[model samples]
Target: MLKIRIIPTILFNNFKLVKGISFDSWRTVGSIMQAVKIYNLREVDELIVMDISATNNKSKVDLDLVNEIANETFMPLTVGGGIKSIEDVSNLLEAGADKVSINTSTFNNDFFVKEASKMFGRQCIVASVDYKIIDKEIVIFSNSGKVSQKVKFIDHIKKMEALGAGEIILTSINLDGTMKGYDIETLSKASANVEIPIIASGGAGKLKDFTDAVKNTDVSALAAASIYHFTNTTPRDVKIYLNSEKIPVRIN
Candidate 1:
């Protein structure tokens, strides 16, 4: 069954779980290990742990944290941060991460994606791209969306796909944290152009947002933070709502 995956995205800064806007002003939420326990009970489809400050902070992969969380959780896990080479990918996978997400490295290291795909297989290599609307068109952003690369969203997605990225996690810098809804218009553009699975990120305020993203954009999955972290919602609830809407979703 082609079910929509309800994933909880956890951001870490300075080795602490935090949440913020456009990837700044991060406020520590909890211990990464503690967050993992909560999500395990919720039975989420998958969990994404990203150390947004690692690149800027110049820290290595939190292998101890990764090992702890992986040991506790039963769902699929993806870890990203300061991943610069194949050795980093190998270390993360060996530490028990199911997948690795690459962003900033792709611009200068185009071959990293292909090399990682060859080493870990395409399914384990996720190309995560951040974008913001410029001149009414979605443009790619790097350095945590602080600078615009000015690359059209569609062009970037095509390049990542051609580079052997197994899947793409597309986030809208403009809509991120707004809770207005997803950038479905932009998401649809990527879906129409790419055959790989697209994970829609940002601007999810309620359950309806998930339904709308999948039904409207045909994105393979929907990811959100504030909606799941600060609200009373759970992945199970999102799946139940999507199922009610006649969308396939795994229920725990």
Candidate 2:
């Protein structure tokens, strides 16, 4: 079995790190730089820094800020938000991002994924999908979960894969920051549909939550913001617990 990754997600808004529940009611966490520096020491597998407001603000992720954060982040860095054009991807990569996570822009121009993949290779692209459950059905949302795409969840992920996205960051808008646990049924189904790596995000509350997803789903990585920020649980602690459960993880 391939080693599972424990990733820390940084939700950045107005130059500060924040965490929110159900993709709303965001609250400031701390200095973005400070958080990155701390994660540098935490033995995390990779780091995802998202400019949560950039899409709504009609602006691209601040390149200068990403350059600054990337300088401090020692692990593989994935940056997302308001990414539209090919140049945006190029600028981000040149600024130090190891991978670029594209969300809202893809809704308007999914061909952008194919173009980026062809230019930079699929491995450089991470297609981010945010969805919410409505009337007992999974519905896709974009623009930071404000607008509903009204598309089928499984079809959307399969589309991303077909478009050459190297991986998918599946985030449940309903479960984000709730710390209730991952939407396991949805994740398991999504995993069974895709061949590439899937980074399961949202609703990670405890150690067992991490273990459960690994044991039950084919997800390659587990990502959370609230558990690491609100609780004392660190990525290392989660890895130790997963290791105790006989799950494969990289320990250093």
Candidate 3:
């Protein structure tokens, strides 16, 4: 059986590590490099670093900063934000990212995901799907949750998988940075629909939340930011808890 992964997320904005409730009211957490160095010692399965401002600013991901973080990250590093072209993917991979997460570009360019996947291989492409519950419905959002894609959540992930994305990072805009818990219903449905690995993101508040999602859903990995940023709980703590609950995790 594939061991469940516990990944820590770094939301990078204006060169600082920040977190916010429901994707707004952003506040700095600490230095980006500082966070990466800390996770390196935590036995995390992987690390996701997103330049949350790059897309809104109409710029590419900060390769220099990614290179800096990549140098310190001991595990696999997935970098995202402002990834619009195959060149951007290539640059990120060259800069030390084990994978690149694509969001806005998947909606805007149409062919970028397919092209990037074909050129770089699907394993290097992580399609990021950010959504909000609108009128009791799941709506896909892009441009860092500022614009709605007007696409159904299930259709979007299926389309991304068909387009050659190796995995999907499903984040709930409603739950992001809230640390209340994950959107388990949506996560379970998504995992049922996709053959690719699904990284359950957003709203991980405590240790029970992690085990809850893993026990109830078929998600391959769990990703969180605020829980790690605001709480004393480490990734290893999460793994140990999951292990106690009979969930398979890499404890060392």
Candidate 4:
């Protein structure tokens, strides 16, 4: 049995850590450095730092910030946002990112996924997808959920996997930051359609949501923000609960 991982996603805007509803209404959370240190102390499975300003602002990843977070974090670090080429991916990895997640590029030039995987290996390439159901069709969103590409969800997942992506970070724009729960329906469909590990993002409000996601979907990981950022649910407590429910989990 594979243990389900609990990861904290830190959204960056203008090189600062912020939180928002459905990826909008941004509010400052804290310094990225402070948040990384806290997650390190809590022993979370992994941490993802995404620069929401990257492509939207016509810029690249802030390596200075990446270096700061990298130096402070002890777990595997996944970085994303505004990553357009292999050179950008290389730069991020050199800055100590364990994985590079690509979103906007996939909609335009998906071959970048294979190129990135070839240069960094599949395990180091994560496909971060922003999706929403529009008129009953799962449409892909880019540019921080402002742009929607009308691609069926399964089609996109298959293409990414075939292109050598190691895993999938499927986020539900509708459920993001809502704290309602994960889009289990979407997760179930995605898991059944892809063999790669699925990381469920958005709408995690409680320990039960995490448990239900791992149990109901084939998600290898659960990613959340507000629950860990504003609420009382510690990764350790969530792990303990999952363990009690007979779900395999790594206790640190």
Candidate 5:
């Protein structure tokens, strides 16, 4: 059995770690490197650090900062935002990212997934999908959730899989930072539609929420922000709770 991964997602504004509600009204969390150091001490299974600025600013990947964080950690680091082309993916992995995640750039250039996966291997590509409830239906959001891709949520997931994206980071823009709970209907639909690992993201508020998501849906991992940023529930605590509940997770 595959041990479900407990991932702490760190968002960066410029070089500083930041957090927000519904992907807006951003606030600083701390320095990027410091956050990674804290997670390292916690012996987290993996860490996902995203550059929240690069896409909005139309900038390039901050390879220097990414490299600095990568140098401080022992586990896998997945970096996203500002990933535009194959060379950018190359630079991220070269700088120390175990995998590269792409979102906004994907709509216009999905072939990047296929080409990068072909060169870097499928396991190195993660497609971050942000969805919102529009007209009571879930649809893909792009440009940091400010715009819609006008693509049906599940169809996009299928496209990503067909294009060779190895994993899907499915996040609910409506539930982001709300601490309500994950969007299970969306998670289940995506997980059922795709054979690749699905990283269920957004709205993870407490320990039971974690258990409920995995128990109810076969997502490979659970990723969250405010629950870890604002609460005392560390990823290790989550793993412990999951183990007590009989959920298979990698324990330290």
Candidate 6:
């Protein structure tokens, strides 16, 4: 059996590492290189670095900086934000990213996902989705959660899978950065509808939050930013806790 992966997502505003609540009011936590070295020491399973300011600023994904960080870490590195075409995907991969995530462009023109998957295997493509609840219904938000897809969340996941996404990263806007826990109901529903892997992201506050998410749903992996950035918990400790709770995890 495959052990569950504990992924730490790193957000970048330019080159500075930052954390925010519900995707707003970002405060710089430290430099990206420093954070990368720390996670490397902790032996994190994977790292996701998203350039939060890229899309809104109409700039490209910071490929140079990503290339620099990818050289520093040994874990699987995935980078996202401002990816518009197949060339961008090639550039990120060439920069040493194991996989590339596309959000706004995928929602706006889903063919990008299909074409990227076709060009460079589905395993290299990740569909990153950010969403919020409105009127007791889940709504898909894109462009870093600033715009709405106006579609049901599960439907979007199915569409992404059909378009050949290797995995889906589902983030809950209301629960993001709140450190409450994973959004189990939404995550469960989304995971059940897709055959591909679902990586649970956002709202992981404590060790129980991770256990609670895996127990409630079959997430392939759980990801967080604030808790890992602001707290003293290490990946090794989390694995120990999960193992003690009888959950399958990879001990580092």
Q: Kindly list the per-residue Cα lDDT of model 4 for residues 97-208, writing each as its tens digit.
A: 9999999999888589989898789999999999887788788998889898877778999999999999999999989989999988899999999999999999999888
lDDT per model, in order? 0.86, 0.93, 0.92, 0.90, 0.90, 0.90
| Lowest lDDT block of 10, candidate 2 | 35-44
Q: TM-score each candidate.
A: 0.96, 0.98, 0.98, 0.97, 0.98, 0.98
Model 6 per-residue lDDT tens digits across residues 65-137: 8888888889899999899999999999998899998999986785999999999999999999999988889
| Model 3 ranges with Cα > 4 A deviation | none
Indicate the residue-level lDDT of 100 in model 6: 92
Name the TM-score of candidate 1: 0.96
Task: Estimate the lDDT of model 3.
Answer: 0.92
Worst 10 residues of 4 by lDDT: 131-140
Which digits, one per residue and each the tens of the lDDT, describe model 2 over residues 115-192? 999999999999999998888999999999999996688989999999999999999999998899999999999999
Shift in Å, residue 233, candidate 5:
1.0
lDDT of 1: 0.86
Which residue pairs show backbone clashes in model 5? none
lDDT score, residue 161, model 4? 97
Model 5, position 39, has a per-residue lDDT of 93
Predicted model with the maximum lDDT: 2
Residue 166 in model 1: lDDT: 91
What is the alpha-carbon lDDT of model 6 when measured against the actual structure? 0.90
Query: Looking at model 1, how many pairs of residues clash?
Result: 0
| CA RMSD per model (angstroms) | 1.2, 0.9, 0.8, 1.0, 0.9, 0.9
**Which 10-residue span in candidate 5 carries the lowest summed lDDT?**
146-155
